[model samples]
Structures are given as structure tokens and as C-alpha cells.
Target: MGWLSDSPQLLILKDCLARRLLSCHVYPELRNLPESAQGEELELADFSAFLAQEVWPTLPPSFREASFETRSALPDDLDSVPLDSTPVSFVDTLVSYGITADAEGAQTLLRKVLAEYVSDACAAPPVWSSTRARECEICEREIPLTYHHLIPRATHAKALKKKWHPASMLNAVAWLCRPCHTVVHQIATNEELARSYHSVDLLLEREDIQRWGKYASKQRFGVRRG
Candidate 1:
């Protein structure tokens, strides 16, 4: 077993890789960072501090207590089970961490996480239900609508280090038609839209012109616009 103290470099690298995995899901631009980049040297203490301060709180309590040893010990062929059973708030978190698992297991975990988060996030209260049939964002087609997290759930799961709860980070979304949904992600992923939609608050806010403005203002990669 690799003790946290004995293999600080390896631990840090693994943590960085985990973070990058999550980032790729949320920030399309980050998907391009070389997988090798995750191996770059970083102080274990500094990385731990970042994880504790920024990442831990976002995770469900079960994962909060998970150690590198426990994770590494998980069987490669662990059967597909309900994500809720894993004790993580978001399904994506579990899936991301389970990347080392087999392909079938990974897909099972990813689907469950995505479905659960979407159900919870978009479960409209009675009052909001009536307004769900508005036109889509791109083609303006009138239909039953839902909020699409501009950041993909897979990506959001990794970025927030939390489950894919819409209520928890609703700001990272867009009011889009199903067709527009695809368009928006394409725009966000390869173009500048991902950077523009980085704000946690605006993304969660009710999709409106104002929120889009805030998203637009911050649309550059690696730089936070004031």
C-alpha cells in the first residue's frame, strides 16, 4: 500500500489527475491539457491544502473520508451498483474516481450519476412547472424545456468535486432547446463560450439575458475577468 507520507509525489500527481479529469468535463478548453501534464510535480502539502480547502467541502461526507489506500483497494471488477449506495452527493464524482475501473462499470456509473443529478436538478417546483414549455434557446422552438447545465454533468461532477445536483450549482446552466443544447456545448467546448460560462452563480441563475452577459464577460480561459 502507498502511504500518503511515503509517496507524496505520486499522491499529488493522482490528485492532480483527478482534478484534471473533472475539469475536462466542465471546462471544454481544459480537455486539451495533456494527460501527461497531470504528472507534473506539486507539493503534497500544497495539493492537499487545495483539495481540503476547495475540493473536500464539495464532496459528500463518504468521499470526504475516503483515502488513497481505500480507493486503490477497490476491486477492478466491482459490479455496477446504484450511485446513491456510494455515499457521494453526485454520481459524476464516483464515476470520475472510478476511471480506473472496467469500461462497463464506468458507463453504468456515469449513466446513473447523470440521470440522478438531472432528475434532482430539474425537478421543478409546482410554480415553475407551468413555465417549462417556453421556446428553446437556439432555434426558439416552443416545447417543454429544462435547464441544461452549460457545463456537462460529467465535467461539473469533476469540477465541483460534488455530485451532479442542479440545486447545488444551478448557476452553471443555460436555458436551451434540446438542439441548442448540443450547439451550446459545442460552442462552449471548442470556442470561447466555456470560459464565458465559468461563473458558478450566473450559470445557476434562471436563464436570462443578464446571466448571459455575466457569462460573456468572463469568457476567457485562465483569466478571471472583473
Candidate 2:
């Protein structure tokens, strides 16, 4: 386990495991490795075999047969090359095989993989302001300059809170203008706000106002209508 720490090789392996587990479409060779083999020691050949079987299958034929020697022949300092023409690193091939040292190293690889995933996922054109204005969902105000999830993400469990995952109940968010957002919080406690969030009608109906009014009158005025 200690050996895996800071090991880029191990990080790649963990990333491979994560992709496999998530069913992210891996090379057939990699998919063939036993589930238990994840996080376990592996010979380079065994790792290579897994990659060939799993990862290689999904890649283009040219990529599959690409010679690492030819790819890595560029000068050591890749920055010196033009943006459109940088040589690939042989180290990348080794990293992809998951022959790294340990779990910590695996984390590093996972971060890189996730970063790529984020980049790819965000490649779609950004939401145009004009288009957003036309389709904005929030009412009683212009759509918020920024969207905020109703359920504060800090309350969510660490594992399920991914940047790329679609927002949901466990991840409920709201889009509110700056003033409305502040007033919304100031008007109610977190628990009450969370409850009121069950429906837009409930929130807009000023049910929170009624609830708070009753509580305040009972405490200060001693004038309960009921």
C-alpha cells in the first residue's frame, strides 16, 4: 500500500479500475481482469494483457498499433514544440497500463482522468446569455445571475457530490438573484427552508411567512388567531 503512494503507475491502475467499475467503456483486455485484481499487485505483462484486451479494443486501429518509440522521439522539453505538434510521451503508455506503485498514486491518476472527463464534458458551447434569458426558469425576478442549488452542497455526503453529476433531490439547487438568495435564507432557518423547498408553490405562497408569523406572534404578541 505504501509503495502505491505517489506512484503514477498505481494511480493509472486505480483510474482503470474506476472506469471499469463505472462501466465507462474500457478496452476488452482490461475488462477481463478479475474484479479482485483491482488494487492488487500485477505483473507488467499481466497489466499489458488486460489493457490490450479491454482498452485497446475501444481505441482506433491506428492508436492500437501506434509505435511508442516513434511517438516519444520528440525533445524532452515538450513546451518547446508548437501547440498543434507535441510528441507523445512513452510514460503515458506505461501510465495507461496501471502498473504504478500504490493507491495514493492511483488518486493522482484519477484526478487527471476526471479532469479530462470534465474538459470533454464541458466542450459543448456554453449557455448563451440571450438564450438563457429566453428560457430562464426562476420567476418574481429575472433569472439569477448564477444558479445556486437549494440544498447546500456542504451538507451532502462527499462521495455523491460530483461536479459533473446532474443535480437531483440529494443535490437540489436553486437559481436565485443575489438579493432573493440572501432574503430567502434570512427569512428562514435551514431546516424550514429545506422543507419549504418541496414545492415551488409552497415557497411562493408565502407558507414560510405564515409559519414564521405564527411563531413570532405566539412568542412576542401572545395573539394566536386560532
Candidate 3:
């Protein structure tokens, strides 16, 4: 803990967890850093102050509070910190600090959260072809199809943190015609889309989307929905 205390690397880790940003394990720049550096920036002191003052303050009040609470929950006793002579692996050493059953519970929760974060960050983006689809997947109209992320990109960080969808489905998308695409967004909020209607099959299950798809399929390319 001494090596991490008041360090830029620790602050960055905390920031990632607080903001629900991709973890250092998956972030390319952080992962690429030399092991000796441990993801710390060159300007350690400046970076630490910046994170503590400028960056952390900009986060939501609730996030800041939560981060503070997690930090405060750690044991204050210097003797509780593991010794360098510990034979266990680094991670094992870190987790071994807690002597109580609650430590195991906390470890379980952390693993679940980290699993979701890493999976979402690792999911590949949809591979788009130079040639666009001739018809919308929804309405089957012969109009230019718009690429739509089933899980809205804007809500991705929050969605992953909320466990709305698994990492494998984060990059899922649908190609829809202009009208159908417009209606899809209009029909649900990003959270709702991530939680309930991410897949094309699920979108088709909605009466409004079904009705709109059928109506749009019959209309000519120039027709607009009122």
C-alpha cells in the first residue's frame, strides 16, 4: 500500500472505477506502460494534484462520495499492509489484507464488477463494409441503411456499470432504414434500449416498432412519418 499511497497510479485507478471508465487492464495506453512505471505518468506529483483537485471535483457528487467511502473503508493500521516478503502473488497479497469474511464478499463483488468492465472494453466494434446494406433490417425498405448500435454508444460506460447487458453484446448493432432508425430512437431511451430492446428480435417484439416497421415498409422512399 505504501508504494500506491498518494500516487498518480492509484488516483487514476480510483478515477476509472468511479467514472465507470474502462479499467487500466484493458485500456491500451495504460496497459502499454512499462511495468516499472505501473501506469504512473511522468509528472507524478502534478498528476496526483490534478487528479485530487481538478479531475476528481468534476465528477458527479455521488461518484465522489462513493469513491471516498471505498477509500475510507480500508484499514488504517500500518501493520495491516502486507510485507514484501510475502510468498503469494501480488494480487493474492492485496486481497489477503482482510482477515474477515466481509473481505471475501468484497472480493467477490470486485471480481464481478471488474469482469463486466473488462468484457465490455474488450468487445470489438462492428466491422462495417464499404458497401451499405440495400434494405433496412427493420422495415426491409430499399433505402440507405443507417448503422445503429443496439447498445447506444453514448450510454455504454453507464450500461456496463449497471450490468444492463453482458460484454459480448456491447458491440451488437442493427442496420435500419432512415424512418425505422428514427422511430427506434424515438421509441425508447438509451437505458431502455440497453436493458430491454438491444437485439433486433427484441425490437421487433415491440408493438410500436412492429407497427412502424410494417407501415414504413409500404411507404415509398420519399414518404415521411408525421
Candidate 4:
């Protein structure tokens, strides 16, 4: 919060992290910052402004509303001052208020915040959805379900492609939530799907898939969906 502006070292670290994000391949223009930032003479302040103004808009739908405020600072005069033309660094603003953040202490504090953010994200599901009708046979995750073609649809499509044969196994379908569906497709090949892994029971036979489903539940203890 206040520390974000109070700690010069922390602000610099955050700017560095954001720069790495800018050079990510997903962004078209700034994929190579060395080339893109060549004429700009951008420093940490420029990048922070770029992140909020330029980059924030281009972020995918999932991250658009991400809150950058880690501290509770008054918003009364924020709109009056232009962020880019602000005369000095954030640390200087804190100095005006008699606040000081040591570099070593700031670095340690930054790491703790970062670690907590990541840990909290991983330890629990961020958002939850439900199918409402039924549970997944694999993970038992209650999210939306789709009718999976237990015998790979690709196999059915291939038969139609090569010999003009219609889909023969019309009854081969399973109810799977999104995550389970993804896991099933990922762990098994198309040949395995048509030959052996054609039923929910057979799929559960693979110890790894079963083991994974067991741990993927919100509780981290697997629940079988019969």
C-alpha cells in the first residue's frame, strides 16, 4: 500500500517484473523491448505508466480489472495530477511525509508479498463454477460438463474421411467436467481411446489419472464420482 510508494527498491523490482511481462511473446509490439524501447528512453516510471495506460488495456479479458493497489492510499488528488509528469519518484513523495523504507527491508518485504500472492492463488481455486446436473466421473469437479466421445471423435472422423463410414459407435459417450475432459484427452492417445480406454471404468484404471483426480479436488483428497 503506502509501502509501494515509500519503498524505492520495491517499486523498481515491480517495474522490472512488469518489463519481463511486456517482453512476453503474447504481446505483439513489445515482444522485444530492446527493439521496441530503443527510441523511447523509458525508465521504471515510464514502464509503470505504460503498464497502467498502454498494457493494461491490451491484457486479455481475465486480467483486465486486476487491482494494482496493494495499499490503502487516499484517492482524493489522484485524478488531478498527471502520473507521467509527477516531478519526482514515488519514494520522494513518501519522503515529503517523513516515511523511509530501507533497501534491504524493502526487498525482503517485496519477496514476502510476492510469495503470499502466489501461494494463496495455488492453494485454492480462484473462481468456481458448477455443472449443476451431474459431477465429473474423473476429478468430480462440479464445473460445466460436456458429452465426451469416449472413443476419440478423431477416430470416428478418420473412418468417415478414409472409407466414408458413418460414426459406428453412437453410444460411446461420457459425462465429464472440463478439467477431467482435459486430463483424459491429455493422458491418453487416440489409439488407446478406441482400443482400451473407451469407457469411464477403463480410464480410471490408469493409476496416474486416478491419482491425479484424487488430488485435484478442492480438498486435495480425491473423491470418486461413481
Candidate 5:
């Protein structure tokens, strides 16, 4: 109960309620309550009604409709506005929707939401851009990109049936240029790829891939490696 006072989202909610309904009352007046049990029940009912009618509609549909467990999974579509690069208008929009009263309040509330929801997937949404990378993620060459499935597609049916990999990762990919992409599959069989090198960082950890990347990065696009 006491901890509720420290919650930024709840505090924002309280502020919105105070601004709309209790502007005439002092802070102490809020603490003062009716002595009778019946009066307390009446007050509780009125507050509940106010929340149902006034506050609930102001929330985002996802926040309002989803259960906590459901909300815990990061949605495929997050606000494209990168969390690090959140503009003043982003905070303003949340405030305007009655989500928070100020930028600090908005940040606190959003950070909590992101921390809870982004766990199963990325720590946070991709920050550099919402669009796909123009350069190869492996060699960093500016060339046409191809999708390199982290868990190679050949293993998808078996992986799904065996639960070796989560279904969400079937489409997981790193954008690599043609040479680097060719080098990857050439170095590892599909089965070994699914087991050992499921991420770009893991692929980079191999000395052969690292050496190839260094060489391929200096060569022009489509140049064959000897």
C-alpha cells in the first residue's frame, strides 16, 4: 500500500484524478475519510466508477486489454521511435493520453514497461533504425543484403517438432552481403549451423569466419574468395 505512492504510473494516475475531480481539496483532505463503514463503501464505489468511466478509456488499447503475462511478451510492432532516441513529442503524446504527467514520469513508466515486456526478445528494440541494415552485419560491406537465417531453414520443421529452437527464431536473420553469406554456409553444414552458430556474434567467434570477414570486408562486392 505504501509502495503504491512511489509508483510513477500510479502517481500520474493520481495526478490525473486530482486534476479532474479534486482540485478544490487539499492533500490532507484526500487522507481524511468518512468515519462510517457505509460511507467508506460509498466512496469506494464512486472511485471505482470514476476509474471505469474516466480513466480506463484514456489508456492505450494494448495496455488496457492485455493481461500482464500477455503484455510481458514484446509485440512485433513496438513504437518505432527508438527508446534511446525518444523525442519530447513522444513523452508529450503519452502525457496527452493521460499515461503520465511529465517527461520524467513518462520515462519512468515507459522504462518499467520496456523492462518487463522486452525480456523474451531483444533487451530493447533495434535502436539504429527501424529499417533493415544497408551494410552486411558480418563484414560491414555496403552491398545488397540477403537474409541469413540464424537457424538455417533446412532445420525449421525438425527444430519446431523437437522444440530445439523457439518458433519465433525461425524467421530470425542477419543481413549479410553475398560473399559473406556464401562463406558462412560453406564453412558450416546446416545441422552444425543450427547447433553452434545461431547468432552473428557466435559466428564471429569462430577464427575462420573472423579471418574471412576481415578479408571479405576489404574486397569489392561479388569478388570471389580464393
Candidate 6:
């Protein structure tokens, strides 16, 4: 009779431990180990630098992955400000579940990232100006500007956010001059663009982008936005 009371409590504890183990960074390597592995032999291999970096992809999602899901929930359309936390959280989720850092995590993670990106398309909405009149969002150069679709149009179906505004309006676009646009496409995939570089500020923060901005805008003095 006493065992029954203990059973539920034991089950709860085991469930908690299982979730915690699933969240471990080393769990995957252990999971891949053979049943015949010896005690000390296996324990030594656990700390080996050889398999550590090589096996990172197979590791279970870390706490950071769980944290990401929380931050990416509220996009601009929800009357929520796009916090600096949004993109950071998104990548964390994507890396945890995305096979190659080229895809989003679960559908929810994908949706949030897409929503935030789509909202940023308007570039501080309620403040749309002439494309020619405004400076390039990336280089800040007042040059010939063009719109860059963050999700690469081809992925629009995968990126559509049913929770946000309409699909027609959810273009997830950004402004960039020719050189900046070229540099972005050169370095990022559609996933990277849609998940991270949806905003001018986000683009400006990258070291690679900084170098490109310097090189691209070398002779082109920026035109101040009207």
C-alpha cells in the first residue's frame, strides 16, 4: 500500500530527470555509445576533445534552446516591440533542432522568427519613405537602394506566419544597396536571412557585414535620409 504512494512520486522524479537528461549537452554521445563499452573506457571518452566538437550536432538541445522558444513568441504584429532577445532566441532554437543551422527548429520557432522578420519588413512601420529618399539600411549609404526579401521568396510558403498579418503584407523585406545586397546573399542562406538578418540593426552588428560595409561604401558617401 505504501508503495503506491511512492510510485507516483517516483514516476514524477524520473520524468523530470529524463527531461533534464534530454537537455544535456553530452547525452547524445552517451546515447550513441555501444552497450558493450567498459566503465573507465567510456568515461575517458566522455571528455575527449576528439569527439566533442565533431559530435556537437547530435547533442540534445541545451537549456538555451528551450529559452529561445520563450523569447521569439511575440512579434511586432502582436503590439510587442521586437526585443533584442527575439533573434538571439530564434537562432538558439534553430541550432538545437535545425539539422544544419540552415533550417528553423520546430514549427513554432519558425513561425516566431518569420513573424518578427515579416514585421521588420516595413522597416519601423508607420514610417515608410521613398526607396530613393532613404539610406541603405545596411551600409547607411545614400545610394541606389533595393528591397531584399529576407526569406528569399522561394521559402515564403515555409515561412508564412498564420498568426501575424496577411501573407501578402508579410513580405519580410529589408533595404540594402547593391553592394550590401550582394554581400548579404553571398554570406547568408534564406534561413539565415529570415531568422537573423531581418533588420538593419541586426545586419550592422555582424563583423563580416562591417567589413563589407566598409568595402562597399568606400567611395559612396551616404545620402542622409529625408
Cα lDDT listed for each candidate? 0.39, 0.39, 0.53, 0.47, 0.58, 0.47
Model 2 agreement with the true structure over 1-226: per-residue lDDT tens digits: 3333222223344445445334423334344455545443343334533433343234333222222222333334432322221112323443454433344443344344433433332234334333333211233343334554454555445313431222234344455455445656686665455444433444556865445434433332224585
Name the best candidate (by lDDT).
5
| Candidate 4: residue pairs that collide | 1-71, 214-222
- All candidates' TM-scores? 0.25, 0.26, 0.41, 0.33, 0.43, 0.38
Worst 10 residues of 1 by lDDT: 1-10
Q: Regarding lDDT, does 2 or 5 come out ahead?
A: 5
> Among all windows of ten consecutive residues in candidate 4, which has the lowest summed lDDT?
62-71
Give the distance in Å from residue 48's predicted Cα in candidate 1 to where it truly belongs: 32
Cand. 5 Cα-lDDT: 0.58
Question: Between 1 and 2, whose TM-score is larger?
Answer: 2
Cα lDDT tens digits for candidate 4, 68-89: 2212232333223223322233
In terms of lDDT, the poorest run of 10 residues in model 2 is 81-90
Ranking by TM-score: 5, 3, 6, 4, 2, 1
Residue-by-residue lDDT tens digits, candidate 5, 1-226: 2333222234334334434334222323323344425554354344423333343344454433333234554455665424454456556644654546788875665555443433422322233234368889888989898888878989999866764554555666888888889999999999788867878898999999999989988887665789
- Give residue 224's lDDT in candidate 2 (0 to 100): 58
Off by over 4 Å in 1: 1-133, 144-147, 161-167, 170-173, 190-195, 198-226
Tens digits of per-residue lDDT for model 1, 87-109? 24233433444442444553453
Candidate 6, superposed: residue stretches over 4 Å from native: 1-133, 161-169, 221-226
After superposition on all CA atoms, how large is the RMSD of candidate 4? Answer: 20.9
Tens digits of per-residue lDDT for model 6 on 96-119? 433224333323333343343333
